[model samples]
Target: MTGHDDWVPFEITPGNTGAEATARGLTAYLQGLDDLAGLLTRKKALVFRDFGVTPEELDVVMDELLPNRLAYVHGNSPRTKVGKNVYTSTEYPQEFTISMHNEMSYAYAWPSRLLFFCQQQPGTGGATPVVDGVRWLAALDPEVREAFKDGVRYTQNLHGGMGLGKSWQDTFETQDRAEVESFLATTGSTWEWKADGGLRVHQDRQATIKHPVTGDEVWFNQADQWHPAGLGDETAKALAQIMPAEDLPQNVTFADGTPIPAEYAVQIRDRGLDSAVDVDWRTGDLMLIDNVAVGHGRRPFTGARRILVAMCD
Candidate 1:
């Protein structure tokens, strides 16, 4: 994409696909297309609109999009698993906007693509905005970009069943501690199990990543979302007053553990949103995004809305 104005996703409707309004039609159209991954990397995002894909046909449509669907394991967002590998998109309050960040960018491994299916439309707003990671990085102030060159450190304090944020069980999607440890071992992360049945984990990762196929270096960390400043004044102050930085449910800092300035976090969050293209949802709409190339977030809305999300490697 050249810039924000030219960075909108490539939309495929009935006109482009020459298909009927059915899931089987979508699958056939996709099955005939060559190098879908190449197209996704070039377009960054894809919209399959007016397909009228029913929930019963979701799995087939998703299989055509890409296979090896992944569970939302180790995900930090507030969500509910409603299917084998599908989840109700971020359950953050409808009145509040969620900042842009790649799905699971804070972790050691992340999905290559994310598919969102809108099961119900909201009364107003609730658009899923996507930001081109390259453009997002380019829009940031040079000083801010330079400061994050070395990447950042992330900390998570997951409780057993009670306390702040997400519980270890929900975070890992398993009751077996051995499974959790086995997963963590592959991430090169350090973790501690507290006497109170809490899990504290620390991981350091780079601020940017290069796409495997396109070889494009893009902004790829969740620093702003993990930092206190990004949590808004009231929440940040309340958390700080209650415990030290390391004790928070989630926290981030410079790779060296130095605090990231509130202003930096603001610039990062605001710039990403500013450069985003909002994809308004309609019932039965489906969207697929190349997770590394584009980061996504939600716009505030009203009334009932349900978007199911699934990802693939």
Candidate 2:
């Protein structure tokens, strides 16, 4: 991976791709691709700026770039599905920054690529900051990395139809218990249905994984995001006082069932954000990221922001 200071998306524009670029936009860019996957694998990320990509034309561009876009099923984040396999980016308060993580890294399966389109840019600061996974891994303290060497266990306590946190129906995108059970079976998760009509799930996953092509080890778990420690102190304390950590909507622990220290979680979260390179948004701009190689998050902004995201295998 390249140095964070020097990292920038490989940009292509109408001016560089010639007259046909104006007519075809991203399709023209796709035509020039000898190997789209290879290019993304090498660069990790690419930006298409000033291509005049409109929402109406986004499907064509998506077809060319991500031929097999996958549905956002079993996704934990709160997002409204906008179209086939596409959704608005996490609708967190514009004042709070979303920390970095590889999409669905906590799951047994994950997307190979993630694409983002900026339909509307925010007034102040809504940049989608991205960090090279390998770089982020290296940026952490050696002790912190060693502590997570074994792996991490993720736990989710989803409610039935209505309760705290995400409902089981929303998490699985299906109301059928049999269907949810079938899906969980495939993921190798241990689950139990509660008397109160809730569900508890547990899955152990590696904290680090090697990139398929590069063979570089990168931090690969969403431990920080899942652990209460990553929440601000006030919120974490308040939640802890209300419910046991194991009963929280989401939580994480060491693979051996040891607790991960709050300071360690904070360090991981802060370092990932500190090491990221922010991609400032512009309306009509699009970004494609090799998900295994890069982790992305949103920065706080003032006015409205509309960024759509889709993922592919």
Candidate 3:
């Protein structure tokens, strides 16, 4: 029930149950321990104003509150920042939308949490939208769920670099065939080389993975996002011709060799969009999100806008 003039924390309606505010300073506010648990339990996100906390204080708060976790740093800082040249194809340079999926969904490892801090708000557009992955998965038909439970597959071109500006080779630090093969093996994926010298890998992972904390089977992968590789260009091109974009399910395949059912894709797309909520950014507002239950992306913006992010475990 206690509050301060400089700090105004309130919950956004609907999807989010947490509190947020733009405050004058962060050190005292962050150090107060009484409300920390409640804030975390109820409101998974907290937005605050920049209060000129020194690097030492910032590190203390981040360490105490977030523990050992990766923070997606952006812009120039004494610490770390995402390089300016990095681009993301999964979303785009334009206002196109990205599908809902956990970060690093194609990889064997994924971050447990994520934090996005907005240093500047765009003149227009570029809303950060998020969806509840668990709820979205729970609403699926039992039969459809079963089909996915059989396994979910993803096909990713190891060379395109998606939007991260760095190709898989660059990210992984080696193009050696043995190293690539070893990486794929750890991900439990199957892959092949393209005639053009690209590598395509497929991962037929379980649609539902037991949550490490809750021990509940949560839906994890979306089928339409991936495809199979290794087929000759002629055959691959032929299949591409015969199939619809969603129907081809090129990335991952079933044990029986079927693509993900189109109906399921439609369902996921509709539900994901329906469940999504957007966070409008204000300068100095920092937002933390539970990546397991929520997926997030940015809206296109014009003018000078800056945001910093750190993915937390």
Candidate 4:
């Protein structure tokens, strides 16, 4: 085990233990577990390297690790669904770093556990950086933390089956409006069908939340990721020029509707990264994250990289 603050995950590798033996050991460890929740509460992340675990092998492992595989409903990022409730990691450009963020923090409910499988390692520099959410919260400026105390309101303008941004059908993974409405209703989110064949949705989420087991307050929202202000000045200005902020695919403001300052947004994004430790990838590497206790992101890379992702409650 590594240091707690800038922690590297506990790892198992073929070098120390044979690949087949590791798989058998891991299976036995999980099967004997009386409290998977309690284990994750203490160690927020775990990495398996050089295990030579292929896609078929992953299925066997996932059956034990993530029994209830979750679908990516109401997910914002662009990804291809590869298997039953499994998807490729974010399809962002390879040269750009995807800033640190908890998976689906803007949504009403998020996966408690995230499993990432590195099928193909990049030629250079494609580390999955992860940060302790509690550390990220404590690293922010006092004023910035205080400013976000009231929480944040998120807005999404998903198109209806077509056009720019995500279509409502794609976002919800269903063509039925009633199903989508019912799902949102359970979350206490408000929505309206726009006359232009679009759906406008609003959700207010908190910046901090307590861990269910540990009861430690951690930075938990995706305000900076969804806010236009978090985009650099040039890009933000261009976006503002093209459309009103509210009409953007997604945007965020204070729960009371006050705009968050661009500086604050940048600070939040930067500090999270600054406090992170990178988990360098190897072919057949697998990483599991406790979503509430840590946030994960990607570093810029060259050449090919393929990572498969699956989430479970």
Candidate 5:
């Protein structure tokens, strides 16, 4: 593994590994790896470039990288399941930028690694920028960092079958109320079922967390993504026009129930994006990210794009 001047992802190619630039060769290379997790932790992210890996052969590569893939349960993103555990990356509008956030950072548990395979590249400006979690934390002002020391409280209003945001069935991937309740019990969250068939849930999570393996403190919460203040004024007003803040799809505040200032959310969102480094997409390119050490986002594009992602704990 070689470094590229402190870039977010360390790239690997046929030239460096002495492996043939083909799907079969990429599988062979992964099969030969001794400590995949350790390598990913150190590098944070790895991109396989110039390798002609195909959609059909993606499972073979997944087998070596993600031995036990996970379903996208308890996730907030809008995506469609494509393969067994593979799903289309967040299906936000192609013209809008999806800010950086560690996948499922708001949940009780999250995938340790994320694997992305680019099936089709956009015509222009569609790079998936990645941010180093440690660097993002350091990029913030001391006061902002200090304010988040007590952690954050996240709230969600998932309707039953209609109305704002995602329905509980879609969010939990199940229609059984018992199943949803059982899962929430394990997450240490407080929840209530509204008379209108909506599910309101709350979770308090640490704003910063230590990497389990390396013990490195990194920004790991999704306060900005969930808070209305973090969203631009126009969008915030649009959402407000639809419903009140508490009734919105999702919301966030400090652990003690105090409101998180709009300025803080804006600072976090801006600093995170500014510190990110893009991993430009190319047809057949693959990227593997250490979820705890990095956060991922999308860049606005003008054309069609198809990127499939799968994750494992």
Candidate 6:
């Protein structure tokens, strides 16, 4: 089967039997799977609408429609409306732009798939954009790609805000310092002290990793995005000269102690943003995207905009 340009729309009538509606919904999902699988190798996104079902009902249908368990659930609310808060709520109202990067790149375990349900769309702006991370990485300079392949290290300080108001001391209240150090060491990360006296840990991770399914290397890391260790205002200003606005004050280094150029970092950011395709959302619309292949973000909107998100592995 080939992919279709138009999305399949269905309506559940009041007179239709429950079983009949379910059968039809399942059929649509199957058709979508067939079409998506034929066109893409690693991922496919399907938009569903007018299924005449509540979110709870859709959950049941999705359980059967997709083979894997729904893994990551998130939202754009002031507080988390669904699953865990990966980042602190303090970063709310921050307008995110679409960039090509894997979900949870820093985590030891990352989700292989992602799904987003748009409960409400903004009156203006706030489009959902996605990009192919693998494709974009391949287009980078050979030297740049090689440097990334050599592995890179980043420092993530999950002490205060990232820990969601839990200080480093609080998080390890029961655990021994040696044990915490061992855990960080096992991850190839180092630690330091923040100027304000909070614990600042340096975490080293891969800059490029092979997709579990596609076996192609994708550039992955959030080194340039947000800094783990909160830097002092004066120190931050000085580091701004050396690093891009996107790269935080924390140092980023190659496995062999080589520093990644600020220019290259900007290139990666630009390419990621360039590859993304935005979906103009409508109220009550559900948009599903492949997290492994695509990175998603939002535009700032005035007034209220309700959106719900669910991530499936």
lDDT of each: 0.92, 0.89, 0.52, 0.87, 0.91, 0.51
In the order shown, what is each candidate's alpha-carbon RMSD?
1.1, 1.4, 8.4, 2.1, 2.0, 7.1
Per-residue CA lDDT of candidate 4, range 58-141, in tens?
888888878799999999988899999999999988988888899999999999999999888999999999998888998899
Colliding residue pairs in candidate 6: 155-203
Give one digit per residue, the lDDT tens place, for model 1 in 76-101.
Answer: 98899998899999999899999999
Off by over 4 Å in 3: 1-24, 34-42, 49-66, 69-91, 160-166, 171-179, 193-195, 215-217, 227-250, 300-306
Candidate 2 residues lying further than 4 Å off, grouped into runs, are: 1-5, 19-23
* Residue-level lDDT for 283 in candidate 2: 86
In order of appearance, the predictions have TM-scores of: 0.98, 0.97, 0.67, 0.94, 0.97, 0.65
lDDT of 6 by residue, 30-106 (tens): 45454543333433455555444444454555454344644332111133435332212212463544344566676
Identify the candidate with maximal lDDT.
Answer: 1
Q: How much is 203 displaced in model 2, in angstroms?
A: 0.7
lDDT of 1: 0.92
Writing each residue's lDDT as its tens digit, candidate 3 over 208-263 gives: 67656544455576554343122324645686787543333235666455766555
lDDT per residue for candidate 2 within 178-269, as digits (tens), equals: 99999999998899999999999999999999999988788888998998878789989999999999999999999989999999899999
Worst 10 residues of 1 by lDDT: 1-10
lDDT of 6 at 63: 53
State in Å the error of residue 238, model 3: 13
Q: Which ten residues in a row have the lowest lDDT in candidate 5?
A: 1-10
